[model samples]
Target: MSTPAALRALLDGRWSDLRERTRRQLGVVELPPHGLDRERHREHVLRQLRVLASAGHPSTGFPVRFGGGGDLGGSVVSFEMLGFGDLSLMVKSGVQWGLFGGAVQALGTERHHERYLREIIELDLLGCFAMTESGHGSDVQHLRTTATYDAAAGEFVVHTPEPSARKDYIGNAARDGQVAVVFAQLVTDGGEHGVHALVVPIREPDGSPCAGVSIEDCGEKAGLNGVDNGRLSFDNVRVPREALLDRYGHVAEDGTYSSPVDGANKRFFTMLGTLVRGRISVAGGALSAAKKALTIAVRHGETRRQFTRPGGGEEVPILDYLVHQRRLLPALATTYALHFAQEELVSTLHEVLGGESDVDDRRQRELESRAAGLKAVATWHTTRTIQECREACGGAGYLAENQLPQLKADTDVFTTFEGDNTVLLQLVAKGLLTGYRDHVGDLDALGMARFVATQFVGVVIERTAARPLIERLVGAVSGDDLHDRGWQLKLFEDREEHVLDGLVRRLRAAGDGDAFEVFNDAQDHVLRAARVHVERIVLEAFVAAIDRCPDTEAAELLERVCDLHVLSAIEADAAWFLGHGRLTPARAKSVTGAVNRLCKLLRPHAATLVEAFAVPTEWITAPIAQR
Candidate 1:
C-alpha cells in the first residue's frame, strides 16, 4: 500500500532535491511536438539547449570556482532526467555539455578550462566530442587523424588523412558546434605518440566551417532528427600548440613530448580513463529511457482492456492477464534493480573523479570496468525493454502520439554508441581475467588473451556493495530456496565465477597460437562472463538499497520486486543453470513458476512500481497512459 510519492522518494536516492527541481523546470520548458521537419526539429532542439543553459542545467557537475554548482551527482542526475522528454534534446544536451564540456573539464588543463568552460556552460560556445570515427568507433587507440607538431611555426597541424578518419555521427558538428575536442594521433620531434585530444575550432562566429575544416550533415535518419548529427574532416587545420588538451600528455614549445605515465599503451588508456564520465552518463540516460518506456506500457496495460474472461465477465485489463503480466512485470522489476545499480555507479563516478586528491589507478580501472559493464548491460537492457514495452501495449503503442514508437526509434542506437556493448563487455572480461592488478588501460583482445595466458592466476569474486550484509546473507543460505536473498546472491556469484574460470582456461589453452583469433572465437563466452558479472553487481546493489530503506512497508514491497527480478533473470538463463547442473531441472522449472506467481501478486501494484520512476507528467503525454 505504499504510495507512489513514497516509492518515488525511495527511488530518488542521493540527488532527490535536484531531480525534483529538474522535473519542475523540465515541465515548464515546453518541448517541440513530434513530427517537425528535420531542420525545424533541429532548430527547436538547439533553442531548447539554450533554454537549458539559461536555466542552469549544464553547470551542476563543474567545479564551483568556475561558476558551476559543482554537484557532480546532481549534474549526472539532471542528464538522466532528460530521457523523460524528447531524446533528441537529451542527446543535444549531452553533446553540448556532457561530452563537449566534460572533455574540456576532464582532459584539458586549467588554461583550456578558464578559456572554454564558462562559454561552454553558458551556451555561448557549442562543441562536439569528436572521438568516434567512421572506421574506429570502438577502437580509439589507432585513429588515423593526426596532430603533428610544427615547432618552427609554434603550431600543430590537424588533418584527417583518410575517409575513415573523418569524425562521423558527431552531435553539434552539423549545425552549431564552434569547436571540437578532436582525438588524433599526436606526433612531435619525429616520433609518434598515441591518441590525444585537441581543442580545434571547426566553425567560425558567422556559423561557417573554419578555413581548413569540412563539415557534412549526417542527414535525417531512423530517429533523433532533432539532433543535427554530422561528419567532420580537417585538411591540415593548423592551430596553436596550446590546442592540445594536455592534462595527461603534453607537448612542450620545443616540440618535446612528455607524459607522466610511461609507455604509449598506458598513456592512451590513462587519457581515455579521464573521460569515463561520458560512458557513465550514457548508462544513466539509457536507464531513464527504459523507465519512461515501462511507465507508459505499465500504465496502458492497467487500463487497456483485452479479451474478456472465459466465463464472460468484463473485458480483462491487459496487465491482469498472466501472459501480459509475464511480459511486462518482470521487466518492470528488473528496471527497479537497474535503477539502484545506476545510482551506485553515479556515486562511484563522483567520488573517484574531480577530487583534489590523486585518483588511484586501481580504483579508476575498477570504476572504468564497472562503468563499461553497466553501460553495456544497461543500454542493451533499455533497447530490449523499450522494444518489449512497445509490443506489450499493442496497437496503441504503435502510434506516434502514444510515444512508444518514438522511444523505440530514438533509443535503437543506444546499444552501439558510448562504446559498442559487445566491445565494452569484453573490457569487463579482461579486467576480471587480469584481476585489475597491473596497468589498467589495455583492453585489446590480443593483449587480453596474452595476459590471460601468462598472468591470469584464478577467478576471484569481489563484492561490490554492502560487503558485510551480502557476505552474511550469502553465507547463511543452505538450500536453493529461491526466495532466500542469500541463495539469489550465491547463484549470481557462482555463475560469474564459473564463467570467468572457464573463460580463463579456454584462453590459456591456446598456448602460443594467434591470441587475437583465439580471443575472437571465444567472444561470446567473454561477453557472457561480463554480463553475468554485471547482473551479480546489479543484484547486490539492489539488496543493498533495500537494506537501506527505512520504511518496512517500502522495504517489503521492494523485497518482492527484487525477488521477481532475480527469478526472472534465472528463468531467462535457465538453460545455462541446468546445463551446469547448478540448478536441477525441477528447480529450474520452479523459477519460471515463481516468476509467474510474483508477476500475478504484483499485478495490482504494477502502476506504483513504474510510477516510482516519477517521470515528469508533461512528458508522459500518451493518451493511453493518461486515461
Candidate 2:
C-alpha cells in the first residue's frame, strides 16, 4: 500500500520516537515459549509477568509524586502496544497497572495510594482485582463477598459466606499477589451500602499466605493461561476500618457512614463505571491482536502463491484474488477504525484526569457515556475482525506458531471482561437515550447547528422532515457507478443520518423499561445502531485525518480507506436501508457493488494501512511479515 505523506510525517515525529522507546523497553522482556497444553500456557503467562516486572513496564503509569515514573498516556500507550508481544503479557500488565493500581487511584483515598500504589506499580507487591465471583461475572452488583464493620475491633471482617460467594477467576490470586483490591458489600450502621472497594493484605511480605485467606487455583482455562486465575475466600479476615479505601464513601468513628455521592445504588454504579478505562484498554489490546494478525495474513497472502496468474502462465500471489482482498482488507479497515477510536479515547481520558473539565456530575456522566459507547463498539468489532483475520490466513491461522490462534483465544475473553458486551451495549443504549432526552427538546431552535455538532444529532435527524428529503435524493443514485463521487458522498452522509434516526426511533419507542432489557430485546437492532454510529464517527475522523496527512499520496490512500470502510459497513447493514424505505431495490444492490469495488481498489495498500497505525514492532511480533 502507498503511504499518505501526511500520516508518514506525523509517524516520524514524537509518535515515532515514543514507539521506538516503548519497543526498546518491551524488547528487553520476552514471554515464554508457547505450548499447546493449557497448563503449560498458564505457566508461560506467569513467567512473562515476572519478565514484564523486571523490565519495569508497569511503573511507567504511576504519579511521580508517589515514586512512579509519571507518563500516564505513554504508559497506557506502551501497554497497548504489548499486544504485539503477547495478549497475556498485555493483560498481565493491565492487571498490574490498570486494575490493581487503578483501583487504588480511582476508588481509594490518598492514604491507600500512598501506602500501596508505588509497591504495586514497581511490582514489588503483585495484586489481583478480586471483583468477579462464582455467582457474578458481568453483574458485579450480585457479588456476595462481605465486609461487615466490626466496630468493637475497629475493623472490617471480610468473609465469603458460601462457596458461591468465593471470588472466582481472579488473575494473580492463587500465586504471586501479596495483596488485592477486593470489591465487596460494605455493611455499616448506615445500612447495607452497595459494593465498595477495600484494600486487603492477602499475604505476608515474604509471600506466605495470611490467616483466613484461602486460595485455590483455577488450574486451566481458555487463553491467557500465563497469568494464574484462582478462587479466593475469606473466613472473617479482619482489617482496620480505614482499609475500606473510602474515596467516595467513608465510615465515621461513631459507626456512621458518609458519602459525597448521593444514593447508595447510584454510587455503586458510579464506582463500578470507573472500570471504563479497563474496557478501553481491552479495546486497545484486542485491536492490536487483530491488526497484527491482518498484517501477517496480508503479507503472507502477497508472498504465498498457490495458483497461476489470471492469464495462466506464471504463479501469482493469493492476494491477487478479489475474494482474498474482500476477506482481509475490511478487517484491516476495522483495525484502523479501532486504533483511531482508541487514540481519541485515550486523549479524552487524559483530559479528564488533567482536570481540563470539572469532574462534576455532568462531566462524569459524559465521560461514562463516551467510555461505554466506544468500549462496546470497539471490543465487539475487535472480536469479529480477529475471527475474520484468522480465517483469512486459512489453515496456517490455527497453528500456535503464527500466534493468530493464541491471539484469538486470549482476546476472546475481552468482550466478556470489563463488562460483558451485551451489558456494556445496554449502558451505551441508556447513554444514547439520556443524550436524546437532553437534546431532543432543543432540536427545534438549534436545528441547523445540530448537523454541525459531533453528538446529539440523532434527535434532530428523527424530529425533522428535511432529513427525509436528503435521504430520498441520495438514495436515488446507483451504488454501481464508480464515477459518481458527489452522489456517493451525499449518499454516505444521508445514510448516516437515517441510521442514527432508525436507532433513535427504536430506543425512543422502547420507552425506558430497564435499559439493558430494552437493548437485549432489541439486541440485533441496538448493536446495528451502535455500529452505524461508531462507523460514522470513525469515517469522519479518517476524513479529518486527511488534512493532517503530510503527503498527498498517503492522504489519498487514507481517504480510500475511509471510503472502503464506510461503504463496507454500510453495505453490511443495507437491510436497514431497505426496511426504512431509504433505498430502492436497485440502489440497495448498488451498495454491495460499491463495497466490493472499494475493497478491490484498496487491496494493493492493505499492508501500508496497518503499518500506518505505527504500532511498535516489539509489541506486535506476530509470525507473519514480509521477509
Q: What do the candidate models score in CA lDDT, each in turn?
A: 0.88, 0.69
Clash number for every model? 0, 15
Task: State how far residue 277 of model 2 sits from its true place (Å).
Answer: 1.3
Question: What local lDDT score does residue 130 receive in model 2, on the 0 to 100 scale?
Answer: 94
Per-model TM values vs. the true structure: 0.97, 0.86
The positional error of residue 158 in candidate 2, measured at the CA in angstroms, is: 1.0
Worst 10 residues of 1 by lDDT: 437-446
Predict model 2's lDDT versus the native. Answer: 0.69
Candidate 1's error at 462, in angstroms?
4.0
Give per-residue CA lDDT, model 1, range 422-506, as digits (tens): 9999889878888886576555566777787787777755566699999999899976578999988998899988998888888
Stretches of candidate 2 exceeding 4 Å from the true structure: 1-16, 36-47, 205-208, 356-358, 436-525, 614-626
Positional deviation of residue 202's Cα in model 1 after best superposition, in angstroms = 1.2
The model with the greatest TM-score is 1
